[model samples]
Target: MDNIDRKMLEILQEDSRITIIDLAKKLNLSRPSVNERFRRLQEKGIIEGFTARISHEKIGKGTLVIIQIGNLKVVCHKFEEIVKEEKAILECHRVTGSDSYFMKAVVSSTKELEELVDRLVPYGQLNTSVVLSSPVSNRTLLPEDEFLHKN
Candidate 1:
């Protein structure tokens, strides 16, 4: 993608709520031009979708666990189906290396985490890590200024 596409992405990442007019003003471009760029970005699948990043802690999701799944070759198809039913499981991945799959789950308490563990046990040999704290988490890809300078 070019510099303008990168800049639009940067602005959206910071705040999805920013009005198209405001975005145009900030970028010093016409409203229609800004809208067109955004449209093209969406069409090219560069801009996937917008969503709010909610805090798990504020919503009573106090437990965070990273589960490593083994023996995925046996039940690859069923694994996706199983994880879909679970609300606590926020992220799932088919990873490389020793483990076949890695999943991040959030629960209300330790007991809930244990229950989540038990629920996953039947799938394969499970190794879980309870998260203590998150030092830095940058969900945003690139800032507008950074993207401009890089290009």
Candidate 2:
């Protein structure tokens, strides 16, 4: 993608609901040009479907937990199938290294966390960590990222 395409992505990340006219103004391009680029971006699959960010705390899922599941060299799909049905699981990824899989989940209380742990115990050995606080999280991505820069 060109600089203009990159800029469009950066702007869209901030506010997906922005109108084509407003986006055109921000990018200093004509409405037709911006519209075409936006359409092309979607067609290319670079811009995935839009989604709303739900607040875990407000939704009664205040506790965030990271889970590492190991020793599932065979029958990985069995574990995957179970987690897919869990509403608490936000992300589950297959990773390289000592861990077979990594997952992020949210719970309302420790009781709920324990219940979740109980259900998954049969699949593999799990190493779970409860998050006390997240100083940096859910940051936007860019083609050229300056992750540490405020501006």
Candidate 3:
């Protein structure tokens, strides 16, 4: 992607709902050009999809837990199956080091967390921590120009 594409991504990261006209205005390009660029970004798989950011607390899932899983008796596919069945697991990462997987989970209470842990114990060893507060929550990705330069 070029500089214009990078700029478009930066703007869209801040506000995905921006109109083609508004985006073109910001980029100082025509509406048709902006629309074509957007279509190309999607076609090239540079822009995956758009989504809303929701508050876990507002959804009655205030309690945030980080779980590190290790020592798997079952296959990776089986462990993944168990994780998929659990509604509370929001994100799961295949991590390196001592841990096999790192998971972010949201629940209603400590009781719920305990229940979730109980279900996961058979799969592997688990080290869990309840999040107090996040100083930095979800930050958007850096512009492609900045990312490329830094690397």
Q: Which candidate achieves the best lDDT against the true structure? A: 3
Clash pairs, candidate 2, are none
lDDT of 1 by residue, 1-151 (tens): 5677777788898999999999998888999999999998799677889988888999999777899998764577788889889999999999898888899999999989989988888888899999998887756685456655764
Could you tell me which 10 consecutive residues in candidate 1 have the lowest summed lDDT?
Answer: 142-151
CA lDDT scores, all candidates in order? 0.85, 0.89, 0.91
Q: Write the per-residue lDDT of candidate 3 for residues 1-151, one digit (tens) a residue.
A: 6788888988998999998989999999999999999999899788999999899999999999999999987988889988998999999988889889999999999899999999999999999999999998867765556664653
Candidate 2 structure lDDT = 0.89
Candidate order, lDDT descending = 3, 2, 1
Better of 1 and 3 by TM-score: 3
lDDT of 2 by residue, 1-151 (tens): 6778889998898899899999999999999999999999899888997888888999899999999999874487877888899988999999999988999999999999999998887788899999999998867777654532432
Give the TM-score of each candidate. 0.89, 0.91, 0.92
Candidate 2 all-Cα RMSD: 4.3
